[model samples]
Target: MADFSSEIRQGIQHISESVFMRLCEKVGTSQRVAMRRETVDIKEMVEQQLAPNDGTIQMLSGSDREGFRLKGSDVDHMYWPNDHRVIMDMSQSEYYNMANTTLILSDSSESPPGFTLLQLLTPTTDIDVLLTCFRINDRVFISSSIFRQLTYLASLPNSDIHGPCVSGDVAGLEYDDTLCFVCDYWPPSASSWIDRCQSWPDPEVVDDIVRNGCHFVAVGHPLGPHANEEWRLSFSQAEYKCVYAMNHSQFLTYGLLKLFLKEVINHNLGKNNTLLCSYHIKTIVLWTIQQNTLPHWCPQNILVGFWVCFKLLLKWVREGICPNFFIPQNNLFLTKVNGSAQNRLFLQLHELYKKGLACLLQSSSVRSYIIDVLCSPRLYICTDESIIKCEVDSDVELFSEILQNDKTLAQVFYSCMKYLYKVQQLIGSHLTQNQVVMLQRLTASILKNSSFILHNMYTYTGVNKQMYIADKISCHMLKSAAKFGCVSDMFYIAMYYYRTLRYREALSVIEMSKVKLAQPYLMYREHVDRDRYTEAVGGQSWSTKMRKAVVLDIILDNAICYINELIPEQQAALHNKQHMLVIPVFLMFHFLEFLCYRHIDTTLSQAALDELQVLVHYDQGLFVRDIFRDISWEILGICQQITGNLQAALYSYQQSLEQYPLNLIQTATHTRIQDVVSYSQNSN
Candidate 1:
């Protein structure tokens, strides 16, 4: 019987290895994690640069910061005004500039573990702060409920409160922004966590974590006596650092636990039920890792690591005591994870444990990976090297998508230029090395777009001294942008030349751009040659590879770069949410080629026109993103109109209208259709 049991364990371990091999491909590898860290840092820097210097610090948090790009995950943001500072005791008040800071003393004597009552130490003229404070026995304390209520009131228009965060959907992405106050000292309640980290996290990491201190979010323990008055201690900064320090396999295991919780457990319990959350999963992983519960956290042992965390969670649920990682005295499962919910959750977890590794098959997100492992046990081999290559390619694609979604042409143009001086100041003093690189990229984009706007503004029917000076400045800016920008950015130079009727120079630039675009590692839109990427950038550092390797689509802002001939079409595109005409690089490239050739060579112009039509009609989302399809079709219709193909132009306009209305150019398309009808009538 012992022999049979040993055989069973061996079989499970073998299956576990295969399962993890597949998970590496699905959940992402080390490269993806590193890229995600850089992406998060860059975004944080950009937000800091753009935000008004209102004595507040903003941080991107949650899974997005943790490096997981899971679908349906909310973007978490934490904001704390520098004016408000929470100290552990009155003695710590010496550290603050009392005149500029609203000192708040943390009183945990009457509160539960991991919770504190903030006592205002000094008088404040701030209305918002005053509104949230009340006197309790002649000592003024900030009320958690009032603080949360004010945050909700001041949140985005459609936002609602979700614990400490104001939750809302913006442009289809869910965002959770938490308003909190900073505490410069690590909470005494969690001081034991530092000692506990002696075995796992390096001593330096522990010291750094302690030095960063903690935050007090506008939330209280539901079961605590002073729930309304108490604020919950948050270790989000320390938590981020801990996650950053995790091994790739360990990170993937955490991701797997989250996936299981979301796809399997949550699906079974339904959305209305809230017994377990991603935080619970995180806490489980953190404790398991810190305690060295698993002997190995390699890819081969990822499932084993996950199983250990899963069993621990089950034990916690059975006992109705989910301890906070930092302060074990604080039972996280005190409220909702008790009573009927506790019993239900335990039974569910127990049943899953009985099924063993088979339980993972229930997770829709990872089910196929398990099946793939089971079916091709012999073929399923995932090495660190292979996983890194796969993940780097995937990271390139994801980063490209993020760049497209996050930075709109108009936003980049206006925001960077508007805050140029502030951005420069922050770059020198505040930003990290990675953030500075990202800022350079942003600077390039700003310079490129600014040149276009200047060129358009100074454009004249006849060349003069003013035109000459503007042209020189615009040309210089475009050349400067190309140095920091992607290969596609060079097309802007071609665009400037074409717009100024320098056909030969434009064609020369276009030819150069075409050669660079043809490079195997030049990723544009959704197009990426993985094998080529591996060959070209597999060994380079994430930042270096991204700088020299990844290519972004060239965006033409309607307000800035559109030709005068397409004023009507440009005006129509401005009705979209971004309030700018956005054109994809390939579409713009072909359009420019057609225009330049129309001035110099008719045959080449017709060929360029034909190519543009083919790309607009037959694009498989490799050239244009789906969100901009309407505009792409409109461009085609406009080109057809320019060529006097009235019937084809009308058909193209109708096609444009048939696509997503998000482009908000339907009115423009309708106008073009009517114009085509009018022209046909006039010809008859």
Candidate 2:
């Protein structure tokens, strides 16, 4: 529903306001009217597209500040902030001539002797992206330069000799070049500058960094003259989204991140980079910068923490200095965004594996990596049992391509799995309403690609093992989920306990859960019939599975009990008051029936759907569309299949898929679906 996507705007002159107003409302309703207007003044547009503090740059004309450039930040702003220009005057020309070709130097340390330089544009536009400079009369000792690629520019000094300044080397930066500076995160040496910076940015740079930016739709021959487009930048600002004023020094690191993140950016000029480059050019300048210099990046924790990303990337682009940044190779970024999840952190982590199969079309590289990491089939998880039949045949057809030999592929899939687990956890109410909304919108916008999910097949594997760490993540998410009124986590917790055969505990959780449902009652009944034990058993595998299920059941039971306390039952008119004291006396126990229900499917298999069905049938008051959409249909279909009704399962799956229509769906996919389509078509 976008007014014009980079895909849509490829060949349109003007998009009718009426046609795409809905899209404008969703992404940038406030700026659409002002954005659609055509104007010949490219300078005005360029200035507008600059960062929030762009005005501060002009104001600091009188100040001695130098070596600073601007950069564009997030996608909230249109792709190009200062990309359109009609070539008018000297100052204006410098802004628009930054297209065509630009050189990319990965790390400065890779280059020896002097500095590394790459040609930016084919010819030249009015814009200058880099401000190169060195010391005054000391060519033997260089200071720093700034890259023009952020909302505002860093006013690095040309004469500030790095002296004995040491830059740190990152170990695994090659991972996410998507945002690599020196590499990993902050190395040890680069983190000492938290106290070194005296100046931040000029005042003008502060004024222009804004929230809503100008949008332009222009095209011509690629890199050809007369390719007209509108551009916008400066407007308003905020703490998380705006530019700072007096405390400019606080944001130099922000400027640094914009540069090295491997993102094509847009912005206006901030300080003078080429100022002293022509006069003073000599010594090696070591740039020290990183994202957050707190804790690990703390000047104390890591001896070479300054090379961390976000900040290090900024330093690399601005000051033309790059050193290895340490990226953690041991990241199991699946459950928690902070590296791991709490409640089933290890459970999710264990799933942090992959079976080299992308719809039977495997990526050899990914397979190789998985084999090496998983140590045979033992390390991987296979959701599709049917695929086992085709494994030998697939290898025969694909030859060695099916072999998991590529290390990079394994790493990538591992990363994907990690992301999926995190995303799964994120689906709970723990995220902010805005974050939830954003995630849903994003999900809707991007079709749920099974392949994509397979790509992040293992985002995190084993981030950390500390029980406290997992609890911390769970605690944070559970709280947020509570606040936003989204208790996906609570539901899962309750289910987990029931699965482990903790009957009493599971009942307590369901009764206390904020969400009122008869499923808890049903689970309690099931648990009472099975999985209950007085003491520990000695079967190892049986015990482990039972233990995991028990924990989950206990958690669920606690949630159920909590609900009773939350909504003190309507004053019992006929009940004895003395028995009310007994009502408060609750036993802490777990249920195994719910655990069996919960563990039925990691992909939310038919069991969970059946539980939801019971809730819908017995508890209309607890039914909510958002909680678990299409569960009734899913259960009905699956139940029919159990009764040898294949047609019903297919129909039910189709209904479920359509019931929760996402934001974005490929038209191609609409005509054909996996679980439902083939069966339905064959039957027809």
Candidate 3:
């Protein structure tokens, strides 16, 4: 009977290992996780560099920063003025230049374990901060409620306040922006946590966490006496670093726990009614790792790690005490998880624990993996080579998404040449290998757009030495951009050549671009022939193929990349603050080829014109994203009008007006239609 029990346990372990292997493929492998971290870091670095130098720091937090692309997850942004500093005592204020800083002292004596009252030590000249302060007991203290209200006022229209965050929808995704104050010193409340972290995180990580200190968010404890005046201590930066330090298996396990909470627990107990959240799950994982509860956190032992976290959560629920990871004395669940709610939650967790591995079946995200593992005990679903291939595929998808969402043109226009110089400085700074490659890609984009702006500026100037110098500089910048940019970036050189009336040189560049675009590994937008991509670039590292693999769009900035021929179309896109005239690579390629060939060979020009017509008519979202469809049709109309097909050009303009008005070129299309109609009437 004992032997039989041991065999059963061994079988369960084997099944768990297999399920975890499948999870690794689904979630991400170690290499993929590392790559994602590097990508996020690089993006944050770029954002910081581009942000206005107005003594404010902006940081991305929450799951997005943690490298999880979970559906419905909100993008969290934390921004704080650097001049407003919070200190534990007045002595800490000596470190700052008082003339330029607003110092606030943290008073946690009467507050909750993780909360504090911010007393203004010096009068702030800033009206926004001054309005949030009031005199109490001969000391001016910043009112949390007033601070929150002031922050909310600056939020997006139709946004609502959620605790310290102002929440709203941005580009169809939910965003939470929090206004916080930075503290240069580590909170004494979390001193025990630093001492407790003797292992798992290593000493250097702990030191880095402490050196970065914490933040004071404008949110008071619900049960504290100073509810309206208290500010909660936030370890967001420290928490992000901790999550970054997690091993891939551990990270995947954390992701699984979150999935379970969302799909199973919350699904059973209504999302709005549940007290358990991703934060609670994160805390459980942190404690489990720090306490060395699990012997190993590898792919094979992922299930065991998850089970340990689950039992710890159950214990917390039963005891009605969910301690904060940074300050164990602070109970995270004190306000919500108690009394009947606590009892009910405990019973539900207990019932799920009794169901054992079968409880995972309730999670739709991982249910199929669990079922597969159970159904095929002998099959090996994961191997090292397969996992590496999966990582590469994930890298391709991530890189493509980043390119598709590129905003380099607008950023460059906003910052002008200052942004370019900052990027150069970033490249020269100490950076990881992956960071350098990512920054190089960004630099290429900035250079390409800046050159276009420079050339456009020259078009408005007289023929002189300055014009000649600007022309040479713009040409050289384009050459440098093509050297560091992706396959599609070569088209910029062709466009420049054509713009200067060098038809033969433009044709030569266009021919080279066509050959590069034909490469199997070249990813265009979200489209990639995966099998061919793998076959061609499978052996290369992600950094090696990152630049050469993707096709970036050509965005014409109305305020910068001004072209006299496209002024009518560019005028339509000027409705927004950042007037973007986005054109797909394929559309621009064919249009430029036709334009250049019109000067060289009419036959080839006709062929290029025919191809453009076909693409504009039959493109089933293969060449253009839906948002750019109107522009595509409008481009087609322009070409048709040039070809003297007045009736066809009028029809194309009508079709352009019929699509979604996102391209914002309906006014331009109407003008073109009227021009075509009047020309036809005069001809008849």
Candidate 4:
């Protein structure tokens, strides 16, 4: 067990160092950097282009600005008129006067004391842009009339009537881009909400966040569906500050936990459709940090730290409620994860933990193998040049019979768990060596045949009851098999010993089985790339063969989905059409690897800016092109200031101010630059 602990520590270090480094190298590449830059550029261009006629365009919220942005993610922008009084002065009747008639009106409504919501389509982004009228004074608005009108607007016809906003495509938008709906408050201010947090957080951090100001994001959608036009006061800036305040190891722990959720829990056995999400994991991490002392986060105790995080998740699963970090009354998991699913997930995690780290502590080469398989390029970019030769015709009849009968993968996992439980219960109750050997082979047989049961369960309706009985029958057969001398049974016997804490016996059995048992194989196979896929099939029209292939793929996904739904923590959405075809679903699975690998590098490089100067130079685009273009130079300057390189920091700050000069950000950047310059002068 102590040896197992050492192996686990080595694995943790490999994850934190080697895997983290690989992620940084991948994320800090020209292609990823360019994608981020292009996203920001598109937002900026759209903002600038829309400014003159519409109003002042501001980038309200983005993961990029907050510093958790990954590649290919979109940016959020807001539109507010230069004159605050323009919309503020409009009466409910006069709301129609302000509308641009050329812009197609999806919905329009009025509120007392003068408020109007005009949902319109913009030319460039082709997403819905929401314009609302309201007065923002020193205090936040809590008007019932306006709230009523906001809620009433839900009845109006629009692409995103279900939620606060819509994405992908709905109606009237000819483009295929995912739409980010925007909402504007005339007297837009989050100061009132910011002031309410004075006694809650570290005062200095709150003060800094207040100085940065906050955005009142519209939350009138039916999802959370609170009061109409209910704007949630966001403290994202403050949240980012809190994240950055952590020591590097602490940050690495946070990143690893996120990776665990995405890769191990989600990608494993096609469980990506589970109710657990990155945001939920992030909130748990934040809560853990807030309650615990700094010593709990020591680098050597990272495994323990990870366990702590997992325990928090387990606690949430059992309780069936995860409180919102800032607002205690708000339940993050309220409608998301049902109680049955929670119990299933709770059991799943319990099994994993009980199995211990030997199962988890794979060699670095193995980790690389897993990462490479997960992050392969085939999952993302479609490089088929066959589009020129092929034609896509939308035949409603062709897709009409496309079956959505498959279940989530979580089902198979649940079945496996039941069998394992039975094995555990029967293993060490005064059993003889022969009995133990029989138990081992039985468990292995159950593991092997569980796949068939899962397939039958997924394909047919109402098969769960039959499968449950079948599972018990399989367990009974194992008891009978105990009389035989099966060499393959030793591996199972050892696993049971390991699980039950008979470590020496477990090791001895493993040693005895070494000559008899073949090496266990893991096939982390690659998804076919678009080029290869196109070449294999050749360019062809949408035919019955293609449709049948699509149906088969859908069936495979349905099996995974059925398995996942057994737990039901994930959002309930049909697997996207791409996922149901011969063509691989949007690019490759490398995203799972990169989730863990990519984040730690950003954290470490930012923390150790001095040592990173050369890498930063090589990946200059990481600084210049991405969402951090404005802040990149500013961060560089801060690093310089800390390292006593005052002249360098001064130059860096100058570049920061030159790129995107927001008053508060520039003021701070300028202050640092000036202080550095003054210190250099004094030294001279």
Candidate 5:
């Protein structure tokens, strides 16, 4: 699809300065924005925003000028210089492609192939989805306990819980419920950019918005827009209660909150969200996600680490790193080293190498992408470093004498990495492991360490590695192969590609591994996971083999539990069109063909799996993992004793855990392993 990042960055900076400033200049002079952001107005964009539009939606509308306000809106205004072509291209890509090719409008023709792969994998993909999870308070408690409370999600053996029952209507209607979040519609004229920002028609649009989540401009003087508690309280409150810190009521703003939410979900897809923020504010210490751990360690979004990385990179360069630096179109130039600067960069890269790629990517998804993207071979890096002992040792190194050792350098490096990661994830990241390896190799070779990798990517993998390597190589070769080194290397490799903003490359590297990374997609697991997967399949593969492999494995391996979730219509649909429906389930069943019917097929607690089994015929091929079949059956024999029946509660649990790869559960699975060991655990 279209590169949403550039538009987002452009939009963000535009909102901050050009949009906010001019509006404020006009409105600050008059206390209002001239138009509503909700409407499509051609005149407003051309004349006011000073931006062009593709033939489609003419102008951005705004009516609720006072309801919302932009604070520090001019902070990053430089990124949004008055560029008409940029704006025009954004409108074109969004209106023509992104808008038209959405899930709701899917059809044989109008339906893009991207959504298909994602469609078939829903039940399994959704197994890990957190219904209404969020980090409350600074400590970042997880909501799996809440998920544990839900009989339905809990019904799926491997699924984890989110928060207490936070239904959309009643999600925040609890005793602790703070301000009620609202996005009520505004009249067209009272519409302003803020209104448009608050309302998105499509989930994809919303996702895009979330990723490029708007940064709040705290309105009140010192603290900003977040200062207005009056605007946040519930309308029915009698005597005002300062329930929580930041007045939960007035707790808005503070730099792209939606982006932060996406990050939280990315890191904790099916795993517990224990790292939720603490409810009380004063004790709210800054919770920084471990450079590697992310939402798991702190599922809540912690932008500090990312900020450090970005700031450090900026500091090192003493200027802005052009977005083009990471995604240059010319291939030959990709590897061309520019003399001293190149050498200097190479030397600095050694430290990164020593720290290891895993260490680099451990934090969140965005960091992984950042490291991978910037790691490209052609980057102009600084080579050697001299102390300038007497302040005259070298030209660029001349200033090096004033500072001290590598610790300061290390700190700066750390900051750059963190910032690069957090910033990119906010909008989107596009790096991968193979690219990271390529970058590592490129960096090592430049530093006279090129031979570190077992093979040259361009030669072994191919030219234009981004397009050359398929998802297969990324997993079967790069991730699983011993040569690329440990997961850390792969992770950093992913981060390197991501920073260069090569989202596809970044995603490949992270997704290659069996386990989830703490990156943004993982942090905001449900949304990014679904959105990206859907986007990749282009709408046609959702209900097919292309669905995420892990999800498919879970479904087929435990066909019964999945069937249990379906209603009669679904059953009739599957039965009525066995010719058609069988294909998708068949694909999942076949993928885990290594695990047999005698095991998974007969093992389900729900009658659904059994019903599905009778509807289709199996190929004559031998089952792959026959050993797992007996092993799983043996475990079922024990559970049978506790539940007192062959097809009781134990059977469902057994069926849920049956078949498929063991590793998927190794991470997200939460269980009470047991109180004591028993010798009778062996017999089937």
Candidate 6:
């Protein structure tokens, strides 16, 4: 690419790294260490009483256990009673009798967020037993032991020293808000109800994560009058694994996302509002990493990734649906924030996008760490995905056998194609890994062979003109491929329409592709032969579904809108075959469209200039003797000036003078850069 002016380079780096540094400060290492120590102590204390017999009733959770907590974050401990059968077999009274006989029962009427804890005073530390029972298996035979255990604990047994051995509550557990711990029991069956997550994640990663001992947590219903009995399986362990696997840049990106949600988005919406949480932000980051390639996540491109994730969050917020990462059925935002509040959060994020990072600039110790490197061009290059390109060329038979045996191959094929389509530009192609290239070739081969087969069938059947193949076969081969879940074909077919200038037809195909995208997730229940596919339908988590939706939306909003939003006259101009179009003119049109559609103009202008610079570098033929070159240069300077990069603006103006055609050069214009810089300095 074209060299960015020093000032613009410095500005981008300062803002990006400043935001990143602030996030590190917010989730400082010292705090993480303290939280870890406290969590270990709590786990040890809870285990001392509960773990000795069965080694079951013990496991601390929350950010402390997950390894991504901010300072002073609440550490959650789950006292998993391992006597699954005994806990479920006994009656409420009998269960109470058993628990009371084993440990000293406390009548401390304090109940924490989810459970009823039995307070215990030890020699060194005071701990509470969360009288919760859970299961590791999903079989219905596996009982809801935790619920029964809690029910037994909640029984009333009056005493002299403790005021009352048990409270008046039917289930010994009482919700007193003052209790340091409460047992939130998820029955074993309920706790392990859902474990079909094998369909969504990469097979390699899934194996690694499973090996790390990720089990479902028993989470109760969000909208329960008494959610004690109704437990939902949780993927918190899996989620923790996903986060912990991230490289340094990925971790930083995730931290930044959480900070944006808290310090910026949540800050804008009042504290009382149930704004987006760090969990939701973390979920978004996990999905982002899974969907994109390794090259796409290079350290230098962390800011781009952060921006992409923020946009995804905005889309979810605007839709008023933040689904639980592992379960699509559970909408995290259902009771969290209403439409008005969601709208406010959306607007706040939109403001950040428009105003650029300058809106979040702060004078703090965090910002000081990166001050020297803030101006380094290495971290602040124009790293947008718009400039990447993906291409495929392969024989039709290459992946035929794989597609036949591996149902998930089709889905992967579709994802690869969609990824390629989004990143491809006329210049500055993105680097693709071997895996992506292989998938692309395999998908292309399948599509080519299918089309060839269909053509041959038509030729043979149409010749007789009676009982034709189209009717008899209905293209059984393609239908079978579709049944096997070949989503990539739809994308390829859509591109054909898009390229032929059939805008409306292209839009319809694009819409259909989205339906096909969700087909596996939605119609999964109906597919009896689930084993045929490495990934079963309906197995996608909430984050997976949202990620797919966001991908489609980006394609539609950016690529499709380029066609749909064109005015009649502009549309007509595009159809002219004889006339040549300059690359800058076409790109500038898109930049203007983005400016018109968005709430802010500065970022759009910067992105547009970045694209133009890239184009000039890779495809100089497009700008040689072209009038748009001068326009691009002058506009770059103006955009830099608007964004408060005076030195960059001066450099851009100087470049503009150099690029001007012979007839356009003038002495008055030559001095413009110096004069503008002098004026800006005096004003400052």
Of the pair 2 and 3, which is ahead by TM-score? 3
- All candidates: TM-score: 0.73, 0.25, 0.81, 0.36, 0.19, 0.36
Per residue, candidate 2 scores C-alpha lDDT tens digits across 39-135 of 1111122223332311211111100011122222111111221222222122333433254322121122222211222222223232333332223
What lDDT score goes with residue 121 in model 1? Answer: 93
How much lDDT does each candidate structure score?
A: 0.77, 0.25, 0.79, 0.41, 0.24, 0.41
lDDT of 5 by residue, 197-305 (tens): 2221234433332232111110111122212211111111100111111111112111122122234312353323222121111011111111222222111112322
Clashes in candidate 1: how many?
Answer: 0
Residue 27 of candidate 1: its Cα lDDT? 70
- So what's the TM-score on candidate 1? 0.73
Consecutive 10-residue window with the lowest summed lDDT within model 2: 173-182
Q: lDDT tens digits, residues 1-684, model 6?
A: 025586665555555554444544454332332333333432233224323333334344556555454542444434443332112222322434343233222211232222222212211111113333222232121112353443334422321111111122211222110111222232223222235434345566566554433232222344553244333344555565565566656776776666556555656554355477777887777766765633455444556677678777777878887755554545667766666877777787677778654434432333444454555535543323222211100111112212211211111233333433432431144422322323333333344334333343455464655335433342343333333223444443443334334445544555565465445332121122233222442343322322231111111111111222222212232333101112233333333323332333446546655664565435544323344454355545554564567787777667756763322322323455666778887998
Indicate whether candidate 2 or candidate 4 has the larger lDDT: 4
Per-residue lDDT for 361 in model 1? 90
Question: To one decimal, what is the Cα RMSD in angstroms of model 4 from the true structure?
Answer: 32.3
Runs in model 6 lying further than 4 Å from the true structure: 1-50, 54-56, 85-205, 208-228, 268-272, 362-684
Top lDDT prediction, candidate number: 3
Give the Cα error of residue 499 in candidate 4, in Å: 78
Quote the lDDT for 97 in model 1: 80
* Alpha-carbon shift of residue 609 in model 1 (angstroms): 10
lDDT of 3 by residue, 1-684 (tens): 133386666666676666666666656666666656676678666665566534567788888678776788888989888678899877787898887788889999999899999989976777778898888789889898998998888655667898898997744678889999999889989999988988868788999999989999999999999899899999998998999888877888898898888888888665468889888999999999989998678766666777889999999999999899999888999999999999988999999999976888898877876677677767665545254455446766567545633546233444657767777677667876656666667677777787777776767678788778987888898898787777777888887787777889989999988888778767776578877777777767555566567777777766654344577887776743226778888998899888889888989988999999999888888887676778888888888888898888888889889876654677788888888989899999
What stretches of model 4 exceed 4 Å from their correct place?
A: 1-23, 26-54, 60-62, 68-163, 169-203, 220-229, 268-273, 293-302, 356-366, 369-684
Q: What's the TM for model 2? A: 0.25
